[model samples]
Target chain A: AQSVTQPDIHITVSEGASLELRCNYSYGATPYLFWYVQSPGQGLQLLLKYFSGDTLVQGIKGFEAEFKRSQSSFNLRKPSVHWSDAAEYFCALPSGAGSYQLTFGKGTKLSVIP
Target chain B: EAGVTQFPSHSVIEKGQTVTLRCDPISGHDNLYWYRRVMGKEIKFLLHFVKESKQDESGMPNNRFLAERTGGTYSTLKVQPAELEDSGVYFCASSPLPSGLAGVLSSYEQYFGPGTRLTVT
Candidate 1:
């Protein structure tokens, strides 16, 4: 079965610190990957995505993710954490080829400290 | 352009009652999707719609749930005799029809709604 995994349930960081959220997928072949963020009372927003070329993909809100095929990982990262960055992050992949349904990870909640 | 929108951001209902959730996708999008995330669980796909037709409903949990996209415009999902375990945040998403170009990633991107939080007491 294909699955998306975000090992950390929660992560905390001080403002201005670097941030990294891990994501790994198990699949027979490379699948389209994405990262999304859900702020409190807000809809899930697409942060970044990886397909075919350019392993490193940049997204909105100063976030970027690199797709590593050998590791089967597409981890999200930010150079500096903002208090506003505190939100739940999810990793996802399309259900199958030519399909629009997404299979998402459990998500990791990020808490920022002053 | 406006994103996907779901009605009744939050709803609290009795276990045996029926509730209908509506989703209005972006004006020109031909693909709409439904997903749910129960407490402490990953978000899961419930179904997909291509215009007015049901493209795939393999993920629907049971027969008690019925979905429709009349006129290929907006969609409605109704759960009859809702169960306690049915409580979750339901999300609606929309995307443009894929152009059939294998490597074009933009065509597959989905815009999501805020999600309706359903609480069955």
Candidate 2:
């Protein structure tokens, strides 16, 4: 079965600092990847996704992710962090070929410090 | 436009009790999915429904769980004699069916609801 791994369980970054959350997947082929964010009292919101084409993909809230096929990683990055950006981040991929169900990582909890 | 909505934002019940969670998907969405996240674990898929039909239910944990979507507009998930292990955040999401060729796969975004938090004492 395909699975996603988020190496960081929690991270703290100062406001205005750059941020990057790592995600790795184990699959036979290049699979579609996604990053989702969950605010304190909100539902999961999609940050971005990588299907095919350019390795870099941009998403909502000024977030971007780079898909590195060699590393089996699709890491989420932001040039500068904001206090509002603190939340739990999840990395996900399809359950299987042609399946819409998603398999997610354990997630990384991000905290912003002023 | 309204996003996916779930009823009973939070529920607390004793073991051996029953509880039902409801979800209302976005208007005109054909695909609905259920997922659960146990405390400290990854969110896992529970099932998928395609217009009142169960497309895939391989993720359902066991027989104690029942899900129904009679008219395809709203869905209900019931847990009979809920167990302590059933405590988790249950999420419902919806998306439109692929629009391209029948067999080809197209990427469609899934909009999620605010999730129902279940706690079994």
Candidate 3:
């Protein structure tokens, strides 16, 4: 089974500071990796996804993630984050065939401090 | 175009009661999926439907959970005799084409719904 792991459970960053959320995955074959964000009591919104080519994939809201096959990781980054960026970030693996589900991480809660 | 739509944004029911959650996928999408997130846990796969057919339902927790997509346009997930463990957010997703095993084996994206939160008290 494919799985995604987000090492950071909680992260606090000063407003306008850089942000990086680490993600690791375990899969027999190369997996489809993604980053999603969810506000409190809200539905998830896709931040970005890495399919093929371009080791670094850019996503909505100034979010970007780099896929490193050597390390089996896809870490999300933002040059400078805003207060609006504060939310729960999830790293996910795509489940195969049946349902084509996106296996999510426990999620990293991002807190932006002013 | 409208995004995925899910009904009853929040539902609170007593344990052992019944609850049904509905999802309307984006128009023209052929693939629809159901996933659940138990509190503090990873979002787990529930089932997948391809034009009213169950492609894979391997992740369904147990017999208590039932999901149906009668017309292949909309879907419903019913939890009967709900248990405390069933409390969590249920998400629906759809894609123009079924993101087959090859897609996962290769790469593709799945659009998501807002999610229906369920509380079994």
- How would you class the docking of model 2? medium
The collision pairs in model 1 are none
- What is candidate 2's lDDT per residue for A11-108, written digit by digit as tens? 99999999999999998888989999999989999899888899999999999999999999999999999999999999999988889999999999
Candidate 3 Cα misplacement greater than 4 A, ranges: A97-99, B98-107
Q: Summing lDDT over every window of 10 consecutive residues in candidate 1 chain B, give the lowest-scoring window.
A: B98-107
Candidate 1 C-alpha lDDT tens digits along B5-120: 99999999999999999999999888888999999999999999999999999989999899999998899999998999999999999888756665246557889999999999
Error of 2 at A12 (Å): 0.4
Model 2 misplaced regions, further than 4 Å: B101-107
- What ranking of all candidate models by lDDT puts the best one first? 2, 1, 3
> What is the clash count of model 3?
0
Q: Which tens-of-lDDT digit does each residue in A35-91 have in candidate 1?
A: 999999999999988877999999999999999999999999999999999999999
lDDT at B97 for candidate 3?
Answer: 70
- Candidate 2 residue B113 Cα shift, in angstroms, is 0.6
